[model samples]
Target: MADGGVDEDEKPVGELFGRLIDESKAYAKAELGLAKVTAEAKAQAAKKPALLGIAAFLFLQAAVVVLCITLALALATLIGPLAGGLIATIVALGIAAGLGLMAKKALESGQ
Candidate 1:
C-alpha cells in the first residue's frame, strides 16, 4: 500500500490507457467512413449538372462552327470561294488569339 498503490475501486493505469486508445481508433475510423460517404454523395449530386454543362459546351461549339461556315458562304458571294474561306479563317484565328490573351490575363490576375 506504500508503493503508490492503486485503490480497490479504481481501474489500473494500463487498462484505462488501452480503453482510451481503442475508443480513439474507433472514432477515427467512423469519421473517415463518414467523410467518404459524404464525398460520394456530393459527387453523385454533381454528376447531372456536369453532364449538362458538357452538353451545352458541345452545342455551343457546333453553333460556332455553323456560324463560321455561314460567314464564309456569305463572303463567297462577294469575293471568290478560296478568298472568302481564307478571310474567314484569318478572322476566326484573330478572334481566337484575342480571346486567348484575355483568358491568360484573367488567369494571371486570379479572377
Candidate 2:
C-alpha cells in the first residue's frame, strides 16, 4: 500500500494473471496439435479396412453383373421360341438398353 491506497508505479496484479492465461493458452494449443496428429493417425488406420471393404463390394458387384449377363444370354436363347420372335426382339432390345445403362454407370464410376 502506498499512501493508504494502491501503488501508482507498481504493476497491476492482473498483468501476472494475464501472463498465466497466455501460458495456459499456449499449452492448450500444443496439446490440441498433438491431438490432431493422433486423430489423423487413428483415422488412417480406420479408413484402410473401410476402403478395402468398399473395393471388395465393388468387385463383388462386378462379378454379379458378369453372372447376370451370362444368365440373360442363356434366357434370351431359351425364351426366343416360347415368346415368339417379335417378343424376343423386344426382350433383346430391353436387355441391350439395360446393358447400355450398366456401361454408362460403370464409366461414370471409373470402374
lDDT of candidate 1 over 71-92, digit per residue (tens)? 8998999998889998889989
Best-matching candidate per lDDT: 1
Off by over 4 Å in 2: 1-11, 81-111
Candidate 2: 10-residue stretch with minimal lDDT: 80-89
Q: How do the residues 25-74 of candidate 2 rate in per-residue lDDT, one tens digit apiece?
A: 99999999999999999999999899999999999979866766665666
lDDT per model vs. reference: 0.92, 0.80
Q: After superposition, how far is residue 77 of candidate 1 from its true place, in Å?
A: 0.5
lDDT of 2: 0.80
Clashing pairs in 2: none
Candidate with maximal TM-score: 1
Q: Per-candidate TM vs. native?
A: 0.87, 0.53
